[model samples]
Target chain A: DQQVKQNSPSLSVQEGRISILNCDYTNSMFDYFLWYKKYPAEGPTFLISISSIKDKNEDGRFTVFLNKSAKHLSLHIVPSQPGDSAVYFCAASNRANAGKSTFGDGTTLTVKP
Target chain B: DVKVTQSSRYLVKRTGEKVFLECVQDMDHENMFWYRQDPGLGLRLIYFSYDVKMKEKGDIPEGYSVSREKKERFSLILESASTNQTSMYLCASSSLGRVWGETQYFGPGTRLLVL
Candidate 1:
């Protein structure tokens, strides 16, 4: 079973606009959510993260909003740049569980110039 | 900066051959993990070790084994590689945490091709 899911396989947005990537989870036990950005042939780098207690977390141009009630979360990049184009993965983990994270299928975001 | 290095960026092996993938972390992390990424399937954990000599099976550990003889290195072993095992393998390491979940740093990944 896929505990975490990224319904959208890919997304496209024009440069200088906003890009939003969505993710959902079935497991309520997950209290921590993290987002990672990956480029071709490179490992994923940490972007932003939010705890279950918080509704949103921001890091520079990247912002992650979490809605526990809806069991959903979204990553927003304002003024998206062409360099932002890459695969984004959403992951969640329950503190009680030895920090084993469940990952979504990932969404490929393309920021057009 | 914390760096996770995988032994190889690409590898090719014949079916039924024994294969080994090595990972080394310079961050002095106590936790190390191995995962395989396949198209459409996402990243599935193969194995993890929280401490030297201690290992745990993750979501998918079949046909795989892990060894952590040193704190900074973790090795994944494939007894007999199969074609289905061809995929990108990633290694990650994180520090042990209490209430907060630490972020895992990953290597560039090793693409394994078993023909």
Candidate 2:
């Protein structure tokens, strides 16, 4: 069973615009959510994360919003740039299970320059 | 900066062959993981080790085994390779001290092809 799911396989947005990537999860036990950005032929790098307590967390150009009621979270990039184009993966895990994470099928973001 | 290095970028092996994939980390992390990435299927964990001489099976550990004789190195062993095992393999390491669910750092993946 897929605990984490990303419905959209790909997304396209214009540069200097906002890019939103959505993800959903079936497991309510997951209290922490993280996003990773991956480039072609390269490993995924950590982007941003949010805890269940907070509804939103922001880091520079990236912002992540979490809704516990909906069991959904989204990663938003403001003024998206060409460098923002990459595959974004949403992962969920709880404190008890520290290193084991359930990752969603990544969403490929394309920022048109 | 933490660095995770895989043994190879690409490899081709014949069926029924024993395949070994090595991974090393320079950060002295206590947690190491091995995952396989297929097209459409995201990263699926095959095995993980929290410390030297300790290991745990992940979501998909069938037809595969792992070893961690040393803290800095982890190895994935395929007893008998099959065509279905052809995929991109990734290695990741994370520190136990982090707060947000152990932020994992990954290395460049190794693409293995079983013919």
Candidate 3:
């Protein structure tokens, strides 16, 4: 069973537009949610995260919103640049689980110039 | 910044050959993990260690074993490599006793192919 799911395998957006990637989770025990960005031939890097206590967290160009009732989370990048193109993964972990993260299938985002 | 390094960026091995993939982390992290990434399956954890000389099996650990003799190093061993094991292997480290959510730092990844 896939606890975390990224239904969309890929997404395309125009430069300077908003790019939104969605993710859903089936486990309600997950308390912490995170997003990681990965490029070709490279490892994934931490992008943004949101705790279950808060509904939203924003960092510069990246923002993550969490809806606990719906068990869904979304990552939004405003004014998307070509360099923002990469595979994005959504992961969740509960404090009781000792931070062992369960990651999604990942969504490949392409920002067109 | 946490830096995780893998021994090789690419490797090739034959079936039934023993393979070892080494990983080292600069940060004094207490937790280390090994994961395999496939084309459509995403990243699946093979094994993880919470402390030196201590380890646990992840979701998929059938063909893999792990060793952690030192705090900064973790190794994944394939007793007999097979063609189906060909994929990208990723190593990650995370410090324990942090906040509610701890972020893991990953290595560049080692692409392994078995003939």
Specify the highest-DockQ model's number: 3
Model 1 docking tier (incorrect/acceptable/medium/high): medium
* Better candidate by TM-score, 1 or 2: 1
DockQ of each: 0.76, 0.77, 0.82
Encode model 1's per-residue lDDT on B1-115: one tens digit a residue: 9999999999999999999999999989988999998888888999999999999999999999999999999999999999999999999998875576768899999999999
Candidate 3 achieves a global lDDT of 0.95
Query: Interface RMSD in Å per candidate, to 1 decimal?
Result: 0.9, 1.1, 0.8
Q: State in Å the error of residue B63, model 1.
A: 1.0
B1-115: candidate 2 lDDT, tens digit per residue: 9999999999999999999999999999999999998878988999999999999999999999999999999999999999999999999999888776878999999999999
Question: Candidate 3 on A1-113: residue-level lDDT in tens?
Answer: 99999999999999999999999999999999999999999999999999999999999999999999999999999989999999999999988876699999999999999
lDDT of 3 by residue, B8-112 (tens): 999999999999999999999999999999987778999999999999999999999999999999999999999999999999999888778789999999999
Name the runs in model 2 displaced over 4 angstroms: none
What's the lDDT for all of these models? 0.93, 0.94, 0.95
Q: How displaced is residue A54 in candidate 3, in Å?
A: 0.4
State candidate 1's DockQ: 0.76
RMSD of 3: 0.6
Q: Write the per-residue lDDT of candidate 2 for residues A44-96, one digit (tens) a residue.
A: 88899898889999999999999899999999999899999999999998888
TM-score of chain B, candidates 1 onward in order: 0.98, 0.98, 0.98
Estimate the TM-score of every prediction: 0.98, 0.97, 0.99
